[model samples]
Target: MTGTETLERPETADKVEHFDVIIVGAGISGIGSAYHLQEQCPDKSFLVLEKFDSFGGTWHMHKYPGVRSDSDLFTFGYRFKPWMSAPIATADEILKYMGEVIDDNDLAPHIRYSHKIEHAAWSSKDKKWTVDVVRLDTGEKRRFTTNFLWMCQGYYNQEQGYTPEWDGMDKYKGQIVHPQTWPEDLDYKGKKVVLIGSGATAATVVPAMADDTEHLTMVQRSPTYFFPGQNANELADLLRAVEVDPMIIHDIVRRVALFQQQEINRRSVEEPEIVKQELLEGVRAFVGPDFDMDKHLTPKYRPWQQRLAFVPDGDLFKCITDGKVSIETDTIECFTETGLKLSSGKEIEADIIITATGFNLSVLGNIPFEVDGKPVNWPETVTYRGMMFTGVPNLLWVFGYFRASWTLRVDLLGDYVCRLLKHMDEMGVKQVTPTIPDSLSDMKVGNWIQEEDFNPNYLVRSMHVMPKAGNHPDWQHTQDYWREKDEIPALDLDTEALVYS
Candidate 1:
């Protein structure tokens, strides 16, 4: 078959099959769960359903220029697989690595592409889930039953990125683009560019565009915390020396890297005044003292209140110093015929306007789940061990945090979930769920996420829901790996969970 043609799988076509476990996403988290589940429960049947045609989730969806990982390969990559490439990985290389992971594990046979999960309903009587799905190619509807449901659908749907309505966007003559849905063929070389938003994407794109664009301006409503990307050459060499022993090498490198990162973070917190002064001094040394450091670099919130934008090898700072890129810290009032009109009544002209705003965090596509016809409200529900939702029996959700590599956290969670499943099987328990007692009162927990951070249009229309940080000790706080292994490994797998007679 040619590259563009879809090969027909007549043997596995248009049929519904049941499994012991059903994983909803084919992304890194979902793939990690599938890998662990297959290893733990080789005797049981399991399947992974991917909404898109390919394996890589976000990497496959985003194809803009300078697309790459924000974190270093040592920490961002899979523990089992040694990142043999440079310290930082390009998007194409990352996608290729993801493909290799899926193929090397022989996971292709168990995956069904173009299958989007629509909704899932649980039956208390049977202690199983009946999931409804749609086949994107043939427009066929189907259903499958599974004993356990794992939602690794990730935090955002690529179909929608956060795009706010600008007052006069329609009147603008220049081409408007959202980085998430970047057009592949659109040419930008030698064009005057204006990139909106001060997040990671903007940080990566501004410097990349400066290489060819006539001029580039990064417009931000507020400042985002920036940090120099500390991808070390020594770490890569060390990993190469111990490549044969992946686990030991991963542990060693991860520990050292985490230590360095935490030390930097600690200094920022413990010696704020000194660190701030040092940072300001560095900025002045890079740019002139006349440069507006407060307007461009000073963040209103504390460091890591959100994620800090990483600049690989000081590329962003270099671009600013070279006068190739400029930062404009003003509220965008509206879109003009030629470019953007700021609140200060000043106009910035551009041939192309790219919106790199952010993303909408969706916990399992905000799908309304029903167990025995009783609807489950997820935001009101507490997260159990930060993996499973309260009252959602036999269901597990995997999510990463702003502090660590998404895959690393999810990998640990996946292993813990598999262990839980194994313990359940040994105990002959059929279903498990967290029961919140009335005696305990709920309180606001972490400020990792806030309502203002999310786009109302996207959240209300799409599948976007935030899980509550649990009120109890078991449910509250995300303490890194050691604490997680202790709590989750000893969790009451044999609790008052249901068992078939």
Candidate 2:
């Protein structure tokens, strides 16, 4: 509480709290950032403001059957924490791990739960940010002032999921649901279900509900790439048998996983056909030679273009091989009273329809922001390494990697931000802003992320609201973790890209 103070507002009887730093969200990134701040910047007084009642932003919100991580937990889990569970983990498993972090670090006291941030304003003159938040539990409006802002609210809308409009949706009789806001009362037992979309969400749900449903069908406009493998890590098992330290085992396994991922990503660009064939072969090994790989498994896009879902034990294919599930690759013509009518005139009859389309992408948690009395339009601001933006001072948003485990960047960025904060103190600077120099002002700026680099429906749909990125590596949020791992640590704080005052 060295830099923190509480003052009574003269106008309203409300109290205003001030701190050295204010972090938004209490999810994986937020929790991990707190650990770093405590370990690296112990002198700084900070608070975590979470809108939800508890932790686990995505994991807590998603309650769909068989909801789990599309990526493995080894890379997804924090580097400081050793994940002793399976490679793939359920929502509950992730939440439990996050809970352990909170308890271990005593982060609960630093986190203000049920605090929804409505507006954030930065003052250049004061070199501080005034944030207006509402306590969701009591509807109490609270004002907080901070020297720095750390955004970890994630990239997607938690309340409303993306469900495409189809004709006759209102006319349909069955229950329609999205995985984001999964209804606890959704009773799909013995019901004929048609789940839309071919991404990870569809892959997770179809196999989990197949046994309980009368008949389950997966309807996708196009196929998506999936890597089906056994859930266990053989190296971890071997290391554990020899009585190796859990922390050391975690470190070794994490590096190995990252190396393998780098190779795959490199090949996906350098030799996409080879990588594509390897992925297809992984799926073919489970579905047998007779299965229609061309029609039901192969995607039109190359490997690594979109997210590659990891299917544990080939569970989805197992459901397909057992004839418990069916796949239809066609455009949805419209919804019938009973089910959906396809462009090929194939009608899928169902009692329930799951629009596992995806989530709605959010820019800076979709919170209205004002900087020095000017409204900040996200689309107009060019990014600085995807963490900081032009004209924005003393703010860092945790926008993670798309090709690799998101938490990989979280760990990397956590270290970088901590170091940056320490560097600012050494320079005796109260405000630091990223500005495009006169020489680089003419640099070509594009959408926050390049569609050609990585395009998912959720991201493509909200490109208009996302921040802009420059063509240069330093000016954009390079999704490549391999490059950023080395580049970020070596970034010169005194460079022309950042202006410190």
Q: Which tens-of-lDDT digit does each residue in 160-200 have in candidate 2?
A: 99999999999899889988888999988888999999999
Candidate 1: TM-score? 0.88
CA displacement after TM-score superposition, residue 108 of candidate 2 (Å): 0.9
Model 1 per-residue lDDT tens digits across residues 335-408: 99999999999899999999998776666766657777666766666776677766788887877755567777
> How much is the lDDT of residue 92 in candidate 2?
97
CA RMSD per model (angstroms): 6.3, 4.1
Best by lDDT: 2
Global lDDT scores for all candidate models: 0.74, 0.91
The TM-score, computed over Cα atoms with residue i paired to residue i, of candidate 2 is 0.97
